[model samples]
Target: MTPEQILPSPQRRQTYWHTALALAVLAAVVWLARRHWPMVETGAVRLAVADQGWLLVAGVATVATWPCSAFAQQGAVPDRLPPGRLVAAQFAASAANHVLPAGLGAGVVTLRFLMRCGIPFAGAATAIAVKGTAGGIVRGALIAMLVAVCPGVLLVPSLDARYLVAVCVAAVGALALLAGPLSDRCRRALTALRAYLGAVHARPVRAAALWGGSLAFVALHCVALVAVTRAVDLPLPPARVALLHLAASTVAALLPTPGGLGSLDVALALALTAAGAPAVAAASAVLGYRLLTVWLPLIPGLVVLGVLVRRGSL
Candidate 1:
C-alpha cells in the first residue's frame, strides 16, 4: 500500500503539517540570522547599570516555574506521581525543552516520567496533552485580560512585511508540533484525550490544580520578564512589559526553534524597542530575561535529568 493509504486521515494530515511547519521555521531561522546577527557587545552597558534587587526578583520567579509545572502535570492525570520526582522532571524537562524545537524535548521527558510513575503510555501521553491545552487556554485568557486593562499595549514593532511573515510562520507552527509526540498511535491518543479529559475536569481538585498551576506557570514567566525590564529601568510600566511579553510569546511560542530561542528574542526585543526603550536597554532586558530563565538553570536541570535517568525515575 502507498504511504498515504497506510496512514489514516488524521495521521496523514499531521505528517503534512509537520513537514510544512519544519520548512517554514527553517526559513524563518535563517532569515533571522541574516537580519540580526550582531547581538553580542551592544547591550553590556545596560546590564552593568541594572538594579541588582530587581534582577534577583527575576531569578526567583524563574526558579518558581518548576513547581507550578509539576503541579499542572499532576492535575492532568489521576495517578499520583511522586512530588520530588515530578518537580525534578519539570526542571530537567526545561533543559531538554531548550534543546529540541517546538517543545518536543519537554513532551518526551514528561511522557517518560509519567510512564515511570506507572501510568500506561496512553494515559501518560494524554496527560501531557491535557497540560498543554490548559497552558494554552490560560495564556490566551491572560492576553485578553492584559489587553483589556492596558490598551495601546502590544505596539506593532515597525511593521515590516518580513517580520509580519516571520511572526505568522511562528504562530502556525505549534499545534502540529505538539501532536508529534502522539503521532505513532494517533487514534489511541485521541481516544485517551477524550476519556481522561472528561475525567480530569470532573474532579474539583484536579481542575483547580490544572488551571491554577497553568496560570502561575505563565504568569511567573511574564513576571520574570517584567522584573528584567525593571532591573534595566526600561521606561514602560510593568503592565505594558507583561503585555508585550504575552504578545511576543504568543506569536513565537509555536515556532520550531528550541524554546523559541531566536524567534522569541527577536519578537521581545522588537516589542520593547517599539515601547520606547532604547535598543541597548531592550537587548539588555532580553539578555537578563534569558539568563534568569534559560541559561542559568540549564546545566543544573541537565544534571538533575541525568540523576533521574540513573535512578530510573524517568
Candidate 2:
C-alpha cells in the first residue's frame, strides 16, 4: 500500500514489453524457419556435407561476408568506428535480419551502432541508404558482366509482354500516388541522401571502399554457392553456377522475405535447373548453400548478437 509500490517504474515496464516482444518474434522466426526446413532435402544435405573440403571452403566464404559488410558499412560513413566492434555489429545484424522482413532488423541494429559511434540520425540513415544503393548497383553490374561473358548460361523464362507492361504501369501509378503526398520527413531524407552521395563521391577512399566492398561481398556469396555446387557434384561449370546465383539472388531480393527464405530457395533451384543441372543435384546444391549461409551459423550469430547487446555495442 506504500506510494512507492503503487506503480511499476516506466523503465521496468519498457523492459518487460521489450522482452515480451523479443520472445514473440523469436518464436515466430523459429516456427517459420522450421516450416521451411523441410524444403531442403535432408538426404541431399547429407550428401553435400560428405565432401568436407568443399564444405569447409563454403563455410569460409560464408564467414567472409561479415567483414565485407563491415567494410561497406564503414565506407558509407566518414566517421571512424572501432574496427573490431564494427565487425561484431555486422555479425549480430545478420542474426537480427532473420527475425524481421525487408531487412528492418539489420537496419535497426546498424542504426543503433552508428548512433553509438557518434553519427547523427539523419547521417546514419543516409549512410545506410548509400550502402544499400552501392550494393544493388554492384550486384546488377556483376550480373550484367556475367551474362555478357557467358551468353546463354542464364535462361530466363519468357514472360508475356502484357504482364511486363502491366507491372510497369502499376509501378508508375504507385509512384504517382506517392509523389502527390510526399511527406516532409521523406523529402528531408531524400535531401540528406543526396548530400551524403556528394560527400561520398568527394572522398575517393570512401567511394572505393564502398564500391569495392560491395562488389567483394556479392562475389564472395556467389563463390560460396559455387563451392556448394561443387560439393553436391553438380555438373554445371563454376562460372555458370556463379552467374545463376547472382541472377537468382538479385531476383530474390525483391521478395522482402526475411533472409529471402522461400523465395530465394525456389529462385535458385529454378535457375540451376534452367542451367541444365539435374533436378536432384540442383536441390542438393541449394540445400547445401543455405545450410552454410543460414542454418549453420545461425546459433553462433545469435549468440554474438546477445553478447553485443549485453556489452552495449548494439
Candidate 3:
C-alpha cells in the first residue's frame, strides 16, 4: 500500500503538525534553561540560605496569578466559560508566552481556547484586546501611583534636548495611522476593540471581574516579586520592591522579548540595584523571581497545553 493510502492524507498531516509542535515545545524549554542556567543557579542558592517562609509566600502568589488571569479573560468574553478549564488554559498560556516574542504564544493559546468555547475568530480576537486593554490600564495606573509615592526610586535621567527625538518618533508613528502598511487593519482592530470594551463593561458584574481581576493579576505578580526579594533578603522595602518591579516590567514589555525573558532579567536587576541593593543581591532576587514565576511552572504548564491540544480544547 502507498504511504498516503496506508495512513490517509489528513491524519498524516495532523500527525506531522503535532510532531512539529511537540518538538518546538521541547526545543524552547531546552533553550530557555540552557540560556538562563547561571541566573537560575544563583537564584536557587540564594533561596536555599534565605527565608523559606517568604519563599512559600512567593510560590503561593505565583500560583494565584493564573486564576486571576482566567477571571479577567472570562470577563472579556460574553460567554460563561468553565472556570477550571479557563484557569488551566491560563497556566498553559503563561508557559507558551515565554516561547514566543511579543506574547504571540499566549495570545494564540487563548484565541484557540476561545474558539473552542464557540466564540468566532473576530470575537475572540476582540475579547483578547479588551482584556489586554484592561491590564494595561491597571499597570499604568499603578505605575503612576508608585511614581508619586516613591520619588527617587526610579532614576529619571536629566532632561536633555535630545529627548525631542521622542517627539519626532511619535509624530512619525501618528502618520502610521494614515498611511502605514497595516494602517487599515490597525484602525479596524482599534474600532473593534473599543466596541468590545464597551460591550463587556455594559454588564456591571462583568466589568467588575474585568477590572478587579486585572488589578489582582498585577498585584499578585508584584507580591510574588516582592516576596522573592524578601526570600533572598534584598535590602529594600516591600512597597519599593513592588514599585521597581512594576516600572522595570513595564519597560521590559516594550522590548518584544518572550515573556520579557532577557529584558526583564536585566531590567529587574538594574532596578533593584538603583534602589540601593548590592549588585550581587539584586541579581539573586531577579533570578529568584524568574525561577519561581517562569521556569518552575513551565513543564506542568506545557503538559496541560498538550492535553488541551490533544482534546481539541485549544
Clash statistics: count for each candidate:
0, 0, 0
Off by more than 4 A, model 3: 1-44, 160-191
In the range 256-296, model 3's lDDT, one tens digit per residue, is 56787777877887788878997667878887789899999
- Give one digit per residue, the lDDT tens place, for model 1 in 42-125: 565668778999999998999999999999998998767799989999999999988876888899999999998889887888
Error of 3 at 264 (Å): 0.9
TM-score attained by model 2: 0.80
Please report, in order, the local distance difference test score of every candidate based on alpha carbons: 0.86, 0.82, 0.85
TM-score of each: 0.79, 0.80, 0.81
Off-target runs (Cα >4 Å) in candidate 2 are 1-49, 156-190
Lowest lDDT sum, 10 consecutive residues, model 2, at 39-48
For candidate 1, the 10 contiguous residues with the lowest summed lDDT are: 33-42
Q: What TM-score does prediction 1 earn?
A: 0.79
Task: List the pairs of residues colliding in candidate 1.
Answer: none
lDDT of 2 by residue, 185-264 (tens): 68987787778888877888888889988988999999899988888788988888988898888887765666766667
Residue 78 accuracy (lDDT) in model 3 = 76
